[model samples]
Target: MNTRGFYDELADRYDLMYADWDASTTRQGRALDALLTTSLGPGPHTVLDDACGIGTQAVGLARLGHRVTGTDLSPRAAARAAREAAARDLALPVAAADMRALPFADASFDAVVCADNALPHLLTAEDVRAALAETRRVLRPGGLLLLSTRPYTALRRIRPTSEAPHVHNGPDGRTITFQLWHWHPDGERYDVELFQLLPSGGTWTTHTSGATYWALPEEETARYLREAGFGEPVLHLPAATGFHQPVLGARRPVPHTRSTL
Candidate 1:
């Protein structure tokens, strides 16, 4: 499926669908707030919300006194984010860009945030690594990188054929329909697809377009972080915070000279 259109169609109603499903928008907002505060220190002025969807959390960060730049693959979603920023009388630079290759210069932001299982949208380990590399490149030395992914144990507990209705509210004040398709697990990776139904009653299906996730254990994710050139990552479990089941906080290493150089 073409995820671009799927998200574009749901851009206006993204919030409503999640509220109906009992998803925690407030908790997510707080998690993002805490992440920004912890990583960039108090009162950060600049931030990047990668895969920012409709700028929900981006707005929250801005409300907390940060200058936010939000990016997403869907143009409609980006526009929605821009409108939301305007409504709040905040300055948000919303752009449509790919996660694997962001349109920014090195050390461009004080911090980068990719929440809501955004990492899983990339289908392979290479994609994940590339996204991380890009994120690291855009962050200042000693900058913070905060991200969340599904726990492997949780993924293991679910069946491949399981179906769930994930809803979102569009800017037009209508509930958007989304159908989730879960596939059998393959090694550490699993496949999932999202389908959006038009409010007019017809189904407009977008294929996963190679959507996959590597359900990395906390240890594995930390190892990946270290390999990606970040400092040691601190793991936070859901018990610590009512947000993500497991959150990883890592810092980009401050540049150092090699003795042999």
Candidate 2:
């Protein structure tokens, strides 16, 4: 099965499934806000929400007065995010696009954000670097790139049989499903199979999909960021700030000009 297609199919119900994860969301948002305040100073402005699933954080940013452009790999997710933005009476440009090849031009944005362990979706360190490069390419000189991801060690602690329940409203009806998963460790990689149960009449259809991604070390992540032309990353625990610890903040390097010889 196409894992990407599964996410697209699950987009409508995405918010409902994770609404109860409020504590986690609040923490992450607060951390992000802190970084924004410290790095770029206060103010609402244009920002890109890369891999914005269902627009939860994007909506929050819009509500905070930032003009947000949210992008997702799934068209269904983009549609849902756009609908949410509309419901809030906010104009958010939600586009269906790949992170590696962002459509925006260079120096087009003031900041770029990728939250909720979204980096892992790329499945490789090179993909993460490409995404970061695209982010750097689009952000103005000295602009910020804020991203959060679960540490490699954290994934090891997650129980194999864990399942999270999510609900979504669709044209057909309310679709409620459980995101059940079993984590299988392979060296530094985690093979994750996610199961969803869809209620059809009285019967529930079980759909299984999976993806594999490297659990990269923080040192490796920092190296990639530096290689991609980002400044050093600052680590902070999500529990401390109500978000992922060490919200990586990097600045786009400003090019130097040679004096007349």
Candidate 3:
């Protein structure tokens, strides 16, 4: 299935995949906030969480007092994000929209964030460029863009059969989340089956969803950003940034024109 349907099916269990979902929100929010403050010069600025899944970043940023908007391909995810924002008393505007073409007017946001390896969802260089171009279109001149992705350089070297499962125990008992990857021979694309196993009374219940993504290396990500009209993209590591994944910082430079002699 496509990403929208895959995520839609897992909306209820998505949060369960994380060890400490609420803590992750705060941590991720702070990391993005720091990048924004340094690259975009302190906000109170309008921000867009383009691939916001269940308000993880949106609501947290809103809590920090920035105006935020969120959008996801899945209607169910977007609705959950909005509801989660409200539950936290943060008013965030979220909708179901494709990342390739955002519904906002040109130059609308001061900054844009696509966290949690969102860009690779496109699965092709052309699609990735289209999404980046659209992101650039909605940003104000000199806008900051923050993105995070897995370090595929290492990932590609070890084409593992499966990822380590994230298992958590709660009042309901145990919930185990993991992914199985079927890599394409090209080495840059993988079909991912996300599985969530939950304790159902006496036995365990399993739910599976599948999707695909292109494995984006830092080099390719930077090249596409520049091709899409972005300025130099700076790479930030988790060691330096305290973020879950490696981050990239880029800017929409001011337009320049030749002067008449």
Which structure among the candidates has the greatest TM-score? Answer: 3
State in Å the error of residue 128, model 1. Answer: 1.2
The best candidate in terms of lDDT: 3
Reference-based lDDT, each prediction: 0.72, 0.72, 0.90
Model 2 error, position 141 (Å): 1.0
> lDDT by residue for model 3 over 101-169, one digit each (tens)?
899999999999998888999987789989999999999999989999998878988987699999877
* Tens-digit per-residue lDDT, 1-261, candidate 2: 354675687685555454353333444555676677778888676789988878877777776678789998888888888887797688889899888999998899888988766777676667888888888899999888887776656555554454456665544455565644445455565555665556677676776666555666566677888989887876666666666344666788777889996
Model 1 spans with C-alpha error above 4 angstroms: 20-27, 163-180, 185-214, 257-261
Q: Write the per-residue lDDT of candidate 1 for residues 184-225, one digit (tens) a residue.
A: 446566555545443443444332323555566667767777
For model 2, the superposed segments whose C-alpha errors exceed 4 Å read 19-30, 156-185, 197-207, 244-246, 256-261
TM-score of 3: 0.97
Clashing pairs in 3: none
Error of 2 at 255 (Å): 3.8
